[model samples]
Target: MYVLAVLSVLHLCCSSPATSQDWPLDCTARKTIPYHSDNGRLFREDDVWNYTTVILREDLGLIVLGTRGVIYALDINNINTKKASVKWDVTDTQQTECTYKGKDQEIDCQNYIRILHTIEDGRIFVCGTNAFNPMCDYMNYTEGQLILQNDQEDGKGKCPFDPFQRFSSVWVEGELYSATSMNFLGSEPVVMRGSPEPIRTEFKTSWLNEPNFVFMDHIPEGANSPTGDDDKVYLFFSETAVEYDFYHKLAVSRVARVCKGDLGGQRTLQRKWTSFVKARLECPVLESQLPYLVQDVFRLCPDDDWNSCIFYAVFTPQMDSSDYSAVCAYSMHDIQQVFTEGKFKTPVTVETSFVKWVMFSGDLPTPRPGACIDAEAREQGIQSSLDLPDKTLQFIRDRPLMDQAVQPISSRPLLVKKGAWFLRIVVAPVAALDGATYPVMFIGTDSGSVLKAVDYPADNAADTFIIEEVQLFQSSNAIKILRLSESTGHLLVGSEVGIVQMPLSSCGRYKSCADCVLARDPYCAWDLTSGQCTAISSAQTQAKRKLIQNLQDGDTSLCPPSEKAKMINTSFVMGSNVKLKCELISNLAEATWYRGDNQLAPSDKHHISRDSLVIPNAGSDDAGMYTCWSTEGIAGHVHRRQEAEFKLTLGTEDPIAPQARSASKGLVGLQVLVVFLSLMLGILVGWNFYKGHFPLPCMQKQRQSSIEDSQADVPGVLEPLHCTEDKTTAPAGNSNNNHTDLANTVPVDGHATEESSI
Candidate 1:
């Protein structure tokens, strides 16, 4: 026992947050459940994996998944129930040619569906790596089956050549807008819209500079726009910084925009975009450290008003063992302010060769550069992009970068998680019982768990609460995509193995009003009619006495007093052991034992284990009414409730020691086995350490990854180290977490994220 206690302390001292995923801390209503196993529906395939591209058609109650050479449509109501499937595989000749180009036949030479999105007219736009010969085709959904189009288009800029490249695309107004590499070697990256001759970014590094795109979405410019601007397509990515000087190349996150109606330049840029502009996205604008890189982005628009939209993104630091992930939000108003009125950054030669980005301070053009041909520009006779002057195009072509960075809404990170790196984010606006809507954030982490957090935008000072966390995937595989369906109240989780449809809430798990109200779950409320905790959405149809909830303040004061706990009688002889058992429903609650009105403390004669109160040598004073109380802190209040009560008397009885109720013999045998196994493991580890088989540190950097040129450092797909797919196909175990970082933390030249535990 002493050795174990010493080892526990030593382990705590040696452990770093960067090296491991600690238990969720400071989170109100923190409860973890295997909700996926008990309630989720999974769809899997034997030979096919990598279900990265998932398109949900809530209207049809179906979810379409794009995998290796095949697309499967599954019923959203039950993911395990397949509705339809279609195959579009790579031919043997294509595979041969891809292998001749020195690509891995099994991993890289096979077709992996990279793009699957709804185009127009209920049709779908699909693109695949197609064995390194990128090709795209349209599919028509008719009568529950996919009809593949005969004519195909060259997917140079529409789809990525490498399956593991960080890629993104969006379909807007019947046109495909994409951000990906244009070559087999992934050297030429472009952000372009598909057309006969697509208008794209310049070939120069000044425009993109080794970018790894994560997300792209179309945001329509509403009538409220002061300039009546054209619709916009925004891109989120991390790229190598051209302006910073550091020991190694620094990577910075950026939010770039392109007008949806932008056409290629008239003369100076020819086929290049004239309205493409990008600005730095500072998650936390701090002079002391570099900003975290964007891993995934989500846009939450509660209503039809475009001004109400908010972009929430997940971020991770470049390198070093900080074991941290951050969440930041940016308003569309702020993003537009930076791109429209902000100063442009131009590349200027500082010395003989070094080039740096500096604010361009020069004469302005007749039509503002990077401004869409909106009502104002149209009234000025700038009818279309083709009619724009060569002078304006030249200015825009030379300076596509912005100087004033777009900081997060509050100029600080909304949440900085220490234990796990958040890989994906999706927000759902849930109407709570309080009549106010709350944006509940579902964050996917590196450990395959989904964290449900609630943010109160009305009150910025109110702390974001992580209400619950649930393991959605059985394996340790990371969650690459998280899609929330408000209509169905489900969160669709996509991993390498398959897809899982998890319900948003399970309120029946909380039996008491205190537990229900203290949960503060926007989806759940205490239904007074049924006299039970239930989901508000499901209970709306039934007649109810009342529905009560307190989201802003998890006020237990509003709840009726907790029911009295029944007392259990137990008699024990003096000098014998006395044990009172208590079961904890919430791990966040603090448990304390009291005898009558006095609190019990651990002494030589008494001890309190996790689930029980033990008296070593029972005395007469120990014979009294013992009650176990649970106190939980929520929304600035301490809510206490009785969990169990027991009364002890001075007489020998059958159920004397509750701990010994089942079988003292079995318990002793299990304890001995555990001690024996622990001793053996310790001896073996010590022997290996003495033999110099390994280092003293629990984990040490095994090898130093060599630096590559800017082009060589293409951040791998879903990059940021472990945030990507694990090298091993099936995980070794379903354990919640493991220690240390990925082998090569940052293999890319422009590292976006560090996968050290976080």
Candidate 2:
């Protein structure tokens, strides 16, 4: 237990996040079910045998595997935090016939396993190769054992002990219809079902040479069935269907349908099952590449609205040219016509060959498709066995499941089939990075490394597939399988070493990064005024410009406080230099620097730093309320922040920017003189005749000529004599208007002579 705990901690430490410059910190993985086992421990070490086949039953929610002919059922759904319990184990009862003394040595004789098909109402059926030795009657299971029972109850048919190497079975209503091979090398192909085993079919020629059973699924509505009813089971597999003249060297994928009613009874075994006829599946492209090792089949998804059912398949080739060896597709209504016609009406012939796809789109075909090879051919004879109906020979056609069995990054399309657009995204298998939710594609190479990428769409077909290669997982063993988490969207990557987890959110940050530049995205821009990355909006540019102008104007305190504003402490020593910081609202109309009530002057020491205030040679005068006030038109109101209260005790007798201080005093004197001059100039401009003249306008109007000499002022006041004013009247014009002379005369106030410049 202590060792287990230590190993767990070690595993965590080893899977830590990547440090600087390490790319692909996270990646996807391929794992076996044992990795998710309870206690997280597999069978006692040295158990190297892998599972030959696996079955997932929805009703039981159990994952059952055939390992060395021993059945191990893991109720995966009953997991406590990704930990599964080993529910049941079935051992081989036939192992007693072998001479092996121990449990470990007896495992080799049991091999070549297939999945279980539910027969009739409740019984489950499975079969495997007995290693071709009559002594190897005893097989192995995980928990219990099963004895080989070849002797029939009634002994009606030849109960020859047949060891099926490769086979597939489908259950309709209650009976099981099986296609199986006879020998390990694959010699004959035959169809048989049930104890009464009514249904039987066989073909004479080597029609299904090394044929792989791909799929068996129920047909939905609108399927082109000969009976015109959609209630049928379709079978998909890869076979060699050659005519007498031509070399049908190319792989042929075929589709055959069987009605649910034809599964059982004596008539099925006796009659030559021509009812299991096949036709070439139609594809738009010529020379389509056939998928190799047409292994597993699954129902993708059904769309009742479109009258369509989709299927998916896995193709793992022993020999492939490119990294991409998997293919997925669907069947369209128009393509199904070839099956109904029982022949390829027109094969899209090209230089490249073709094969049929067991799984297309998301749903499986009508019949349970065979995986690896047609079980009927294997059951009849061996790999050399044939299962061709007479009518199928006339077509002598080719079936292609994919294009270019292996596709390079450049040649692959963004979409695969006519209906589904393929996105060439590869998810990396690196630790922590693998489990991310980004839509990624993962490529497991022949070498140990796994490549992860984003399928960024290119502008056209000629352009290469744009892949954001995010990570690479370096392992020493081949990747077995990849499981994507549907909920968190994290990729659970499994390798021979262990499993790795990567969250998708962390991956988006480096989506556009190149292989070399991911570690150092150092070109990050910060606009001080906007307080965000410079690429955000136009406000950033404007704020940046304002910050520059403020610096030029010697206003060093530029950066504004954060929204949840707080004061930060920063200072320099008095002896050397000091910085008094003030944060001004950016783009403000005017900011005042105040030391108590005295306003500050713009100088080198009092100027703005890049975005802060820098003060050199601190002095007492530089102390007190160093505040930044902004009053821009846009602000609608003034804002102030007292950035610092510098109590500078002069460390040095001398001051920096002394000329600036002296110039500022001079400016004050000039300002006072200008104010006085402005007042004098206003009085002079309004005087109309003289610089210092002063008079009350009301008094002047009253003293104007009244036209009567003896007018009003005679009551208790002295009056001037009008006759004395005429004494200096002009002589000749003398005779005229001597009386008017008094009104034109100037008033004298104790002066020697009176003058009227008026």
lDDT of 2 by residue, 491-556 (tens): 333333333343322312321112112211111123444444322223333532331111011222
How accurate locally is residue 315 in candidate 2, as Cα lDDT from 0 to 100?
A: 40
- Predicted model with the maximum lDDT: 1
Candidate 2 segments whose C-alpha is farther than 4 A from its true place: 1-48, 57-61, 75-108, 111-113, 117-126, 130-167, 191-195, 220-230, 244-249, 263-269, 281-297, 303-306, 313-328, 332-335, 341-758
Report how far residue 430 has shifted in candidate 1, in Å.
Answer: 1.3
For each candidate, C-alpha RMSD in Å?
Answer: 27.4, 32.1
lDDT for 651 in candidate 2 is: 45
Clashes of 1: 2
lDDT of 2 at 658: 61
In model 1, the runs with Cα more than 4 Å from the true position are: 1-29, 222-226, 285-288, 457-460, 569-581, 601-623, 648-758
**Native-structure RMSD, model 2:** 32.1
lDDT of 1 by residue, 1-758 (tens): 63344334333221122132222234433777764467578778899888878888876778888988789888877888888899988989999999999999888998899998886687788899999999998887678887788578899999999998999999887888999999999889999988877889988877899998999999888357787778889999999988676657889999998888787776777877888889999975222265678999999887767887899999886754445677789998899899878998888887778887788888779788988888888898888788899889888888888899998776666666656678999988888876788888899988888888887653444367788888878647899888877677788898888788888998987898888888889989888778899998778978745888888778877677789899999888878878889887776677789988989888786698767898877878778899999877765678788989998898855443555665887888899999999999999997665443553322222111211121245333222122233244324562322342444454344333334322
- In order, the Cα lDDT scores of the candidates are 0.79, 0.36
